[model samples]
Target chain A: MSSERIITVRALTRVEGEGALHVRLDGDEVEDVRLSIYEAPRFFEAFLRERSIEDVPDLTARICGICPVAYQMSSVHALEAALGITITPTIRRLRRLMYCGEWIESHSLHVFLLHAADFFGCASGIELARQFPQQVNDGLQIKQAGNALLEVLGGRAIHPVNVRIGGFHRLPAAGELTALLPKLREARSAAIAAADWIAEFEFPACEFECEWVALTHPDEYPMNAGLIGSTRFPAIEVDEFEDHFEETQVHHSTALHATRRERQTPYLLGPLSRLNLNRDRLRKPAREIAQRLLPQRVIHNRFLSIAARLVEIVHCLDEAIESIQDYRAEGEASCRYAARSGRGCAATEAPRGTLYHAYEISDDGRVRRAKIVPPTSQNQRQIETDLAHFLPAVLDQPDDQIALSCEKLIRSYDPCISCSTHFLKLTMERR
Target chain B: MNTHSRITAVLGLGSPHGDDQFGWSVVDALTHCRRALPSIHVRLVKLRHPIDVISWINDQTQVHLIDAAVGCPIDQVLRLRCKVPTEWRTIECLPAKGTHDLSLGTVLGTAESLDKPIESVTLWLGPAQQCSPIQLMSARTAEAVDACARKLEQTIRGAGPLADPNSHLTPQSVPPSARAGAVTRAEDFDGEMPDSRIDLER
Candidate 1:
């Protein structure tokens, strides 16, 4: 008779928000794995109803402190689509610049502070800093450069008060944009070095088949606007997102787990997904690094996502510098639009992954309904599936070792539990 | 680039809501009193997260951190002068919870780990209750905030010779009257100090 064992992590640390993981095992066989997101539903979507359409961007921006710009971008773009407003070319470039700041800040924090410690077996980011003070300092400086960009562009670093429905409430001065050039240049160089350094770290050998999903743009790497592109399909309009994808409420988690309607299986998103779908659109330096380090056209190794984040960091810094150099206050700060009843949807590539927002505006410009699908929620199901596949090899180890391995895998996804319930304690049972 | 400069940063950590706003109120008071002591180069910064204290610590040799503490008797002010910054977790008055995962303890630990240029750390904590998220600050907490601010103001005023890079301004550096009610650590308290890791979830 095989013995029954269960491993449970009551509360997971080092990740954002509250969550737990449970694994059930019978002898050598993996019975079940669940990434339980226990945080209460924040009801952002429900509360957004009946609010004025103009307030959607600001209101939604409060959803997540770490990725406020992404929320603002998705909400504003979706609202603009609903209002039928075409932003000017300069406004579009500025939006991209704001996104560059967000990506650099969010990705840098995850790469160095949250995720890197796992690779070194360090207990915390502080422990990692103790050993690699220079790396941690570099990361903080890079993050500060991003924060400076955000403060200048969006009016504040966290939950920017400047973003409006059509465009910015105020434009940055040329000097303000020019001032960021030196910092952005330094960050780009640091990011390139970090990427090369991370690439040399030994990743745990594991790969599982899952569809890669991301927003794809023809002219540039996707940020503000794009069509939904996946490895299994060509491309679909943001309007067609619901027709292809579905978010289902799982019993174990408060967050809605996403899946393809056709297959009803977990798919992947985030840095790896974006890299796989849009590698060619990367900025020249990022592309060169990606080519040299990651030569493969499609990267299935989820652990390499850290490397992907660093690559994107380098890319965003380069993009930010270029945008600042070419910036000008052209036309009006915002586009002119009138209120009318319409529905629109938009997807922007957030630091973690694609963030989709759909809004229905009343003729009087009040929001009738709001649906926001944060990247963390979309990735939750895939995390469970990945854990199930990845746990078998480490099953022979002690329960604590197994739990640590599971935590390492989950952190690799950098699941923001707070965002996902809009979503790991780990439990392993052997029978 | 003078690494030896004596820059004293008084960082007030608090949220905008209810008694949690105690730190901000004290900082606001100090900002008003700043002009009175123009000779002292004390920088006052209001922060929402403890980790943000790191950014201001880079150039400063001496630092004062002000925050509100729950689970203690209201109107009482607690002070801890960190001789060893990494032992911040030993303070029972510290609200173990952080803005996300970065608590004051964690921030102090990180600062020590990074070896930031700092000479001394004085943490001033005011007793807080009813830290309601959206409600205005409680009256008692506001009174406590004022008292703490006055004490800090006197201490900052007494910290002279701002031009001297080697000079340090700790709470003990001032006269006994400036730190009359301040306790050295949780162990010295006449009353029972709660666990340092006060699980807020409970």
Candidate 2:
């Protein structure tokens, strides 16, 4: 009989916020593991109670600087639903383009800076650059192309100021699209090259059983719009999401933990989920790339999550350029929205995974009730599951090495703890 | 990458947390004096780890690093302008590699590593009291940010292109408006609220 050993990583690296890991071992038998969140939660929902809906996008963007696009998209979409307004086709496309930019920016940053750092045995992206300057430069330029897309489409790249309830505050002229052609072309090559490069990375063979879920659309890879669901069921509508899933709140985090209602377990969401659930929906070119890179099958190997992200980045860049080329300035900048009493739910694919927000707004437009479930929340349980399973196999590795491996596992999801909790606590007493 | 040159780089740090964004508050406080000076081409670079400093810089020409240091006193912001008079030492990179994967400090380290000619580099670290992983800044940090911005403007009034580690150069006043297009813009990116805004509550 083999004896078990245990190790713990007090904190993880290559991620947005802070988290620690704990494991139990018995004679080489992996037992229990808990991924603990140490970062303080900023009560975004609580602080948002009295604020005007107009400010919600900017405020919520603070949830995760990395995934600002997701927060803005979710909050804005909810507001649009609550106000009962239909935005223009151009506006819809514009939002999608902005989302594409975000995905590209985030995914490229992760592949080069976080995940690749792990495979290359480097402390960080900066360290990785020393060994490979051109690779780092390419990654940066790729990131810049994504940022440039956001800058032109959404105004400022990070926490863009242009996206509004109806459409952009000011739409760029057609000329702007041409200016991006050269860069987009360069980024296209970079994305493909990056995918090929990452494909060459050594991946540990490990797999787990968790439900894969994401938004699915009939026409294209789901981004700004979709119905909530997983490979487990026909795609469920957004409002029905509550019926299919549940979030358990605890003192450990301001964000709640989410589990599928049917399975009472954490369902997979994010790049891998979307890729597996909607592989066919990717645009023809993107589909061709995916076909070359990924065989037609469900990838449960956690390390392949990086591959999924690269494929998605390529998908977004292609769409971003196409959307910009098709952008027109004819539509009214915005539509009038009146306050109404109703419940609204909206979901968007953040760089990491799925982000959902539901709000109850009064006739006067004040938020009556709010529930935000960031992608990271849904994956927290899954990460814990992976740790529990992984501990037994890698018990002999150095503690730091083990911790880094675990960090890579988590980072594969690109957890944005900052996005998961957006509110800051005042912590004051009248006394 | 020149790992040998002691080039100086200046980084202006501020927090978007609450009003702590006021670290950029001095944007408007300093009056524009020399609007005619042509904009200079800076190797605007960012990196995640201090180790990459040598490669990105190729060769250093006075590098600058800017960021908000957490837990600082408000309105009493200090901009420590000094040259790291020693050879490049390996420094640990900040977590999240900084908000942008492209951190100013990381780039400099790369420049120095490649044997670039970086005469001197400066870090503009504003204090952020809460210093929570989130960007939210404490009240004191906000005030300090504004004070620091103002002080930066004052210091630059006679500060010329800093080339030597010990040279005392006069600042050539450039009108803020002329400094507009991306350059001379603060990394903190504080200024008037955007002229155009989307009605977020559609």
Candidate 3:
């Protein structure tokens, strides 16, 4: 004889956007798991059709408030590639600095506010703050420092208006860039403290075998552009992304799940993947911290992602300060370019993971086609796969406990449901 | 009262979509009517999200937050004076569905938790229906925006609350003596007002 029970979390809390989780089990055997993203499909692709190429950066920046820089960087790079425009070295350095701000802002928010509470068994960051006020305050200060950089460079913190297809509408004055150094330096100390603090959390001893994918740059940690590499494959250019990977629609989600085309296997992205691929490229301070904390070529435990995020935050602050100290006005705010019919695609490492943008532009400077693959969608299938492996151990607990455990696992990925299909709810079933 | 001693920040929180732009419209109206309240040094900030309020109101002693509210009547205004951390959680005007999951109320709670130097907060809310197609405010919403903005101007001037029995700005608009201190519930003032707290963080 067999008994059946079902567990459901009507709405998930603490993560960005909306989403839900469901698991079905039969007599202690995990049958199926689903990370359903019900957030309505924002037809940004269709919206870009026939729009001016100049509008691409600002328009795509609207996709996610938390990681707008990711969208802006990817769109501008892809459009520049399409128009065959090359940016100056100074402009390239400034763009990297802007990305550093975003990574700091985003990673700090996730590590302290979103994921930290899960470790302490608290329901929300506010709850965790009651016990660790100083830590929470430090986190907010670190996040504010990042926002300071974004405000100066990107125009406004959320959905920056300064970025254009070629470069920027205006370059921030040298004083404006230098003024942020004090706060950024403070934030650097906070990030290091944060990494040390998070390293103490007892990460659940659950490891899974998975392929990690990220952009690989020879010189520095990859932020803007590089060869797309995965643990399973050597490398592929951004143009060959579609050939190697494909997105497929699943019945339960509005977000399309992405998998490697040849192996038809799920892949993971975000800080863990970035650290595994580019650990040696990290700045000395961050690399030293990573060595002390992780000391592994590859980490399979998803929960240690918070550690990776803090380490990256340290690296970003260091890079941002260096870029500001070496600042110059250069020749022009932007590179001059002519619109031509061409197809181009580019990928950048978003705070969350790799963000890929491809565009087909006409001779008239209008967008003919557009495709954007946010990292959350690429990791959706892998999230479900992780749950299947993660659920059996927690299945003996009450439904609510199981639900909370599942949410903890999901939050480790820091899935932005709004960026993917949009929202989340969780449910579990037994038969 | 010396207005300069009290630095006030007037924050209009809105996205540029349909009626949702009420917060921005109010800030714009306030900026245009600055001459009327010359005695006060008010910082008028237009913000896209409530979380931004944390950074925008860094040194402000008093803050007036105006935004479009769902679940209320179209033309009516809901007012709340936030004095404590818990008061912010009860005022259910902000949405938590987006990527930035921090609602206005949650952000206020967070602000207090982070020990931000915000002494007092007064919220002016007008009803909202749409959020898309960009920058198109309904006529009713526009009227509500002006009324809310005028009320804020009067508040900034340190003028005592004025009574208008026919006004949709009710309860708190009457007087502090007549209503409960700061935390005025819509149900306490008008029977027709929908319990606007229905959609709060479920």
DockQ of each: 0.29, 0.13, 0.42
Q: What are the per-residue Cα lDDT tens digits for candidate 3 across B1-202?
A: 5535767788888765677788889999989999887545778877765666776545545788877766445557766555433333445523255434656665666677677754467677676766663449887778888878877787777663522323233333332211110111222233332311211211
Task: Return the top candidate by lDDT.
Answer: 3
lDDT, candidate 3, A279-308, per-residue tens? 999999999889877857788999989889
Model 3 DockQ, alpha carbons vs. true complex: 0.42
lDDT of 2 by residue, A45-81 (tens): 8878867777788878767667778888998898888
Which 10-residue window in model 2 chain A sums to the lowest lDDT? A422-431
Write one digit per residue (lDDT tens) for candidate 1, span A40-134.
Answer: 78788998899998888887886776788999999999999999999989999999999999899888888877788888988777798898888
Which one wins by TM-score: 1 or 2?
1
Cα distance off (Å), candidate 3, residue A381:
0.6
Ten contiguous residues minimizing lDDT sum, candidate 1 chain B: B175-184
Comparing 1 and 3 on DockQ, the stronger one: 3
Q: What are the runs in model 3 whose C-alpha is more than 4 Å off?
A: B1-3, B34-40, B56-60, B84-89, B92-95, B115-119, B132-135, B160-202
Docking class of 2: incorrect
Off by over 4 Å in 1: B1-49, B68-73, B83-100, B118-121, B126-202
True contacts kept of 1: 0.31
Candidate 3 chain A has its poorest 10 consecutive residues by lDDT at A417-426
Each model's lDDT: 0.76, 0.62, 0.79
